[model samples]
Target chain A: MSAAPPSPAPRAAVDGETSRRRGLGWLLLVPGMLWLAVFFLFPTIQLFFTSLYDPSGSYEQGYTMTWHVMNYVDAVTDTWNLFVRSFAYAGIATVVCLALSYPLAYAIAFKAGRWKNFLLVLVIAPFFTSFLLRTLAWRTILSDQGPVTSFLQTIAVLPDDGRLLATPVAVIAGLVYNFMPFMTLPLYASLDKVDHRLIEAAGDLYSSPIAGFRRVTFPLSLPGVVSGTLLTFIPACGDYINAELLGTPKQYMVGNRIQSAFLTEHNYPLAASLSLILMAVVVVMVVLYIRRAGTEDLV
Target chain B: MTGSLASRERATAAVPPPPARRPAGRWLADHLVLLLGILVLVYMFVPIGYIFALSFNQPSGRGATAEFESFTWSNWGSVCEPEGLCESLKLSFAVSLTATVLATLLGTLMAFALVRHSFRGRSASNLLIFLPMATPEVVMGSSLLAMFVSLGFDGVLGFVTIVIAHVMFCLSFVVVTVKARLVGMDARLEQAAMDLYANEWQTFRLVTLPLAMPGIVAAALLSFTLSFDDFIVTNFTAGQSVTFPLYVYGAKLKDFPPQLFVVGSAMFLVSFAVVIAAELWRRRRSTWSR
Candidate 1:
């Protein structure tokens, strides 16, 4: 049932009801809000402050805020090449995911008919396994002695010494494989909402099928495209697991750098700076996209 | 059905030209989209098949062999009867279950608040809730680690820490999902119950809660899957305890254990069953509603 039709309820009655509801709502939200504020937001703010001050041995040397602005500079300029490479890999993976997922999503949304649900389930099934296991499985498949290598050799595609594992290509492939479902599901939702009659009408107007798709289907699916790309690209840019498991040192992304800085190098300031920069980049891109396409473009 | 019929009528009225006999090429072209879809599906699934096949292939008694000349259950048996593998699996399930329960409670409350009320700073809180969900897991993990260390919360990295981290991350998903369901729900039913002399708690229990159960269940299942499958965040937070993924990661570094595959396959099967069940339930509910 929809809302009750407008009745001239007394103003005092409505005010009392609304206020009571508001009070209840606040009560409901208190536990969650307090949990997040103390645990999540507070820690993140602490991280920002920690980044500004240099730690002396332990966390509590009564440290002063030095505002190591150079931490940001060092993260960007010192490891500038790595940062660029991370974006390059993430960008390529996003494009590849788009190229592959669009057709699959289109088919499931518009053409698969009875098989669409099964196909969608198939896309999600891989995620059932641990991500590490999937990455390791790739490692086995891509190893020099693995069947894939041998098959490539048989097909004359291998350059006798070319390796698949620990390469940028491998890293990108892993990223695409891992994140493709994120791209597909959103795209499918968008495509499914499109009115097929629009395409039929375009066809009736003497538009070619390709022209009809370009004019009708593609434009309607722009929201999905933008959302899917954002989902894949942002995570891909920040991914370290795949690169660490699949790629060589040269292929390390910003995520890998941050992980090492925090874990091994003990460089909290630098790590925080890098983390902030990565977040800033993502926020800016999202803001720009939202401005251009409207917030509804995101799911 | 009415929309489709009206559109079909409109099409027939507009295009009176006799249907041209479909050519062979036209038939092929019409089905090309489906064919490409199948190809994409194959690409997505083949690697999974390859992994399964490799898992079963017997280790030729020398080194790792890719050929699947023989299948053996030794790997599965070995993993099942170990000093710690089973323990790790038990810990994983326990931690995940605990996290799911906590997350569902907090997240559902947050969702209720977000959907049912208008309050100051509501928008900011909404954004804050969602931001953690979107943030990179690595950043969340390391930041939590930093936070824990800063607070002198030593040895807080075992089961408690892992569960806490999981709940923290999973809370947002639950909030988002439940809020969506709440947005679509008719609030008038609760109001009607209240009008019938039911208190707020009674109305929620009798009317709102039952209606929201499907969404709550879905949210719970999703949170469980997320917590169970999480590696990046747990890796940072789980101090001494080794969950299944952490175990697999450590095992991989030394020698990729075939047992890891068996454990992986077991997890995959369980999660797949749960997801399929959830999907079937959702479908049945929708059909019943229809």
Candidate 2:
């Protein structure tokens, strides 16, 4: 894995039968791509159609496709704050995840030497334990009488009445923690691809460590940065678990609203509309961000 | 510490080019980033520690599970004492295993096609693979549920629905992971095998499959992990069945059980041990191959 073959070798020989091989290639793609088309692409299209269902329709009577564009209008008008809040929280959490993951990924890529694989294992080890269990554990640690909250109170970083649980800070903290690996792994992948000699050359030219990183290492790792931020932000925006467990209703993001609107309330139209809105905003942001970052290989 | 130190020394010795003697400041900078990195990794493990510790905590009553009431061996001793706890665990394993198999097989095929073949609609297929991953879980879940509802499959939502949903989401990740591995591979190995008069099938079976095995294994592990830990998609589709995550979510509504933490800790221990053993085996195998 450390070999880092700089130039990518060409893929398997084309076998010299373009037409037949084309059919063969399509055969291989049929199973998985068809699955995605049916389950993913179609469902999304189905969801768009569902979003146009009459607002009064419920799951019981089945929805009528009245093209009630008002569903989207109502969804935005009603939950604009939740949309704003979700993006805000996810943005903050993504930035925090980037800040924390960059050094760790940098170390693993360039500095860990023989310990890289072991340390990488440690990074992923926590996933074996369920995320819900870990998030619940955070609830205990941030509880009013828990050590973290108590320590904060004692230090006066928090007011006497203030606590970590049921606060936006706790919710964001959970987001940062849970989605951190998403940021780190991509950063490490891109960083590991970087040529160390480039940085060494920069140093040979008497560039300082920070300047070398800024000029050489950081620029090379931009692909990872773009993907990491996207990975963190997308999930953080959609995640209801952290907010539901670590926060109060006041701290609830659009995710919490979507969950209740769909599952609890059984309001399919509203849920579909909310989901569309979220997906649209995310797709737009991601397109612009990817355009700026210039990495079509992210997928 | 000594093992790591000795290994580091051996690692440097094995390489032909000795690293130049760095100034004190450079050495400090190098070690400082590594130290900072290790510290962050350790900090991430705090919750796992808390889970293991809390598993020993037999919360005295329904309201006390959030705090450590007292330490006792009872929770571990009777990990399955809570009703439906073992049942949910079994269901989760069954669901995740089936999903992992389906996702890995399909994804490996897609990855091979994407990386090794120039076919029509390939870029479109790549976009298809990317779409599910880019979409939020909530969006995917809601959309899937909408599709099911429209098809009148909502009433039959159970084990099968959960498996389908898991495979759908896990497929994208598996494709990407396997594709990365395939793209990085040395294709000359396959060409050499072919040049040696190995048939296409023989070369693929002997060379390509073994090379792709690591990525497939990783993708399978990832799919299983994602399926097991999944809440949103499963919740949307799992109508009557209770996977472990569903069980955990349900526990919060009523009497939160201390046994949940015990089960969680046991899972951590078992999985961590397996991972460490695999790493050791991989190291030994790599060294032997070298």
Candidate 3:
């Protein structure tokens, strides 16, 4: 293979070659970009408009574009508690995920030795099963007859005859369990890329282990933190399956409401408005989050 | 996607294990992270273990998933006992297969373009690719449904819409994963091929494509898994269609059948096997390349 060399191409030839490939590049891009334009960009614009439709319209009669901006207001006021609960639960789940994953990701990155791949696979293995099934597994685990409940009861953690299912605690547990992998993988990616010598260098400078981590390793891994949090927080914030399967109505998040509005009540305006509001809030939160994390390319 | 892990694993695998005997305090300190890791892994795996166990459970009582009455091999053998379960699985497979192919093709091409060519709207195009991933599943679902309804396609919302939605979401991830691999690629190899008088297409077919194959395969795997496991967007866009997640969710509203656990365990086992196979294959290929 090494014996087949002809002559080295000149610089002008390389430039010409690059220019020649430019048209083909966009040719390659158009199909995917067009798909996004149709499926992503257009739908977002469509959702924004649908959010402004008249709330009084129905499917049989066909909805009119009344530009009802109050749909957003009504959506907010009607489901304010759901919104708060959703963010609060997702926020807590994100924090818990970060905590649980940090040590595990750190171990995988710096300590697992030959078992790194095996351990990392464990992070995403649960997700290979049905998301609903895993959440339902929580339902069983937290049920009154389950071992967790019995143990908690015996230890005086839960009251006698008191249950865990249909509670906010169960719902939050599901969120944390389901999304923790999303947090762990990204954190592992960033942590794995960190130069091991940097930590040793910090130790040579007389900084303690905790101080070295805080002053060096942690800062470099903020990209993972930002990305991991965003990935976990976004879907966790929008998730209704955990809340629906493990939670009663009292524990329902905005996702439950939005879902019901679309599926059961057939209130397109309300659902669209709710969806738009969720998107807007998530985008704003992500932008501010990335800004604070100071890693613009977290994706 | 596995690129980050692949490079690090070999580097860390050579480190020698700690000595067997040590003081209690020192041992605890040295293995603290390891214990924490094992605990975290257990937390992640306990549910899967329960599901696998329940796959063989004989449901003598209601709330089948809630209690394990007796062990039976019937459920795994006859997973189709529950109505609509197999049908939903078929639909999910169809959607996932179609979406994965389209997504991998489009995303791989887009990745090559984004990495190799600087265009007028490349930055904006990158943002557009990132938008689908940044948006929550529920929002993405509802927005797509809203667009479908507005465009008078609500009556037709089923498999086609599900495929579209799946591809749309999966495409961005495919682009990013492949683009990362492409960006990390050394262009000198391709230039060396060119210097050896190989033409552009020949170079791509023989050298460039092989280099990008791992990333492409990873993206395709990711797309299929995402599409198959998807619930939120699939729920919104699938009017009369029921994918696997939807089927599982629907079962919860019913008798909460035991057969579903079989399905869950099967999914985990199959995907884990595929992952292991792919990893092994990649290792052999890498060795051959070196």
Candidate 4:
């Protein structure tokens, strides 16, 4: 698995079959492409248009295509705090996930030896259960009378009345717990390819182990770090389940707001605008991050 | 210390020798990540443990059992005791099945096309495939809902809308998984079949399909799990429909039944068994071939 054969070899061999294969290829591609274009792309365009609909018009009253750009401006103004808080919470969770996952990934990549596959499976095992159920369990774990909070209080890590359940800390913890696998898998994939000999060579050249890791190992693993952060951060930013289940309205992020707006309040324009803004921001961050990571094969 | 010293000596003396034992500190450092990794793994399973343990608990009062009143085998015996739970579970199964089949069929074809044949707009198609995966669930859900509302399907949101949403999101994942398998396949197998006086259809049926079966199956499983587990996208388009997760969420508001925990536990165990069996079978196959 470590050294996959390059993809171009078979392409070169099949280059002569173009005329017949091309028609087959197009035929094969049509159904999926048409589905995506109709459902995904067309919906996205509708969403954009919906974002610009007249905010005063109710769903029953029928929204007009006024191209009301202030919906974007008003979305930013109204939910700017929530938007900023979303990115902030997701950013911190990404960092925390990185901190927790990097060592684990490194261990599995280099040290697990015979148990590598088992450990990797273990990493993904928790995900088989519903994420919502898992978050709900965290509510029990972090509840006022729960063991975790009680232990924290006993250890003086918390004030006697201080609780984790309804705070940003809980929300962030949920995000970290939920997205850790995303961070670890890519890190392991990249770290698995790091040659042990290079670290040994660094040691042999009189560099200390820590220095060797800092200068060599970490740099070699930067691609994983970049991809892992992006993967963790992007979904984390849009996640509302954690906030909804584990936190109060005070800790609610943009997702919670957008969800309520669309589903409960029937505020289509606001929800649409918020959705588009979040997508725009996420795309920008991901592209900038991938570019900085200097990888062209991210897809 | 001694291992490093010996390596240092060898480095300076330009002579290779048997490696020395690592120092205690280095050994600790080497194991530290493993220990930490184990701890992190344990942390991940805490909630799962809660789910499993709570499944057997007899809650004294209603409103989502936080404390275990007593241990009982009743929840497992009557897993569908909760009203609407079984119905929601059945709905989830139906929707996920429909979505998985549609997504897998469409995606596998696209995967073959992308991997085996060059096409115009290939890069654009790739980007199109990736857009859904990159976009957040909230955004995707809202967009689909917006599209449905605009098309006057708002009143008719239910099973059909849920399946459409599930298929749309699951398609990209299926394509990616199957495409990886197709790309990694040895073209020689198919070529050799053709060389052996086999027609194109015969070559595909005999060689290509068999080799790609694992990936297709994997993609199907992934699609099924994703659709079954989906809540956000379904919540938007489902309207009055209740999938399993939606049932659980609604139960959270009214009465968090221990039976829900049973369902969660069962889902986990079933999927876990499938994965483990697949892994063991794969290992056995490799050894047998060798």
Candidate 2 — what's its lDDT?
A: 0.86
Best by TM-score: 2
* Superior by DockQ: candidate 2 or candidate 3: 3
Per-residue lDDT for B1-290 in model 4, tens only? 55865676567457532344334545777888789988888898999999898899888887846776799999999987788999999999999999999999999999888888776777778888878877899999989988888788978999999998999999988997898788778888888998899998999999999999999998998899789888889998998889998998998999788988888898888888888888889899999999
Please count the clashing residue pairs in each candidate, in the order shown. Answer: 1, 0, 0, 2
Against the native chain B, what TM-score does each candidate's chain B reach? 0.82, 0.90, 0.88, 0.89
Clashing pairs in 2: none
| Tens-place lDDT digits, model 1, residues A204-269 | 654446656777789889978987887898778888988998898888988988888887777787
Alpha carbon deviation, residue B91, candidate 3 (Å): 1.5
Candidate 4 C-alpha lDDT tens digits along A1-299:
01112235324345567666778889999999999999889998889989999999997788888999999999999999999999999999999999999989999998999888888888888888988888888888888988999999999999999999999999999999988887998899889989999988876665555757887799889878986887799889999999999999999999999999998899899999999999999988887777777775552
For candidate 3, write residues B136-231 as lDDT tens digits: 888888888878877889789999999999999999899988987887788899989999999989999999999998899889988998999999
- Candidate 2 on A179-203: residue-level lDDT in tens? 9889999999999999989999766
Better candidate by lDDT, 2 or 3: 2
Off by over 4 Å in 2: A1-16, B1-24
Models ranked on lDDT: 4, 2, 3, 1
Off by over 4 Å in 4: A1-16, A197-200, A203-207, B1-25
Pairs clashing within candidate 4: B1-B23, B64-B256
* RMSD to the hidden true structure, all candidates: 5.3, 6.9, 7.2, 4.2
Candidate 1: C-alpha lDDT: 0.78
Per-residue lDDT tens digits of candidate 2, residues B174-228?
Answer: 9888888888788889989989999989999999999999999989998988999
Model 1: residues with Cα > 4 Å off, grouped in runs: A1-13, A55-64, A153-157, B1-30, B60-70, B187-203, B277-290
Candidate 3, DockQ to 2 decimals?
0.41
State, as a TM-score between 0 and 1, how close model 1 is to the true structure: 0.88
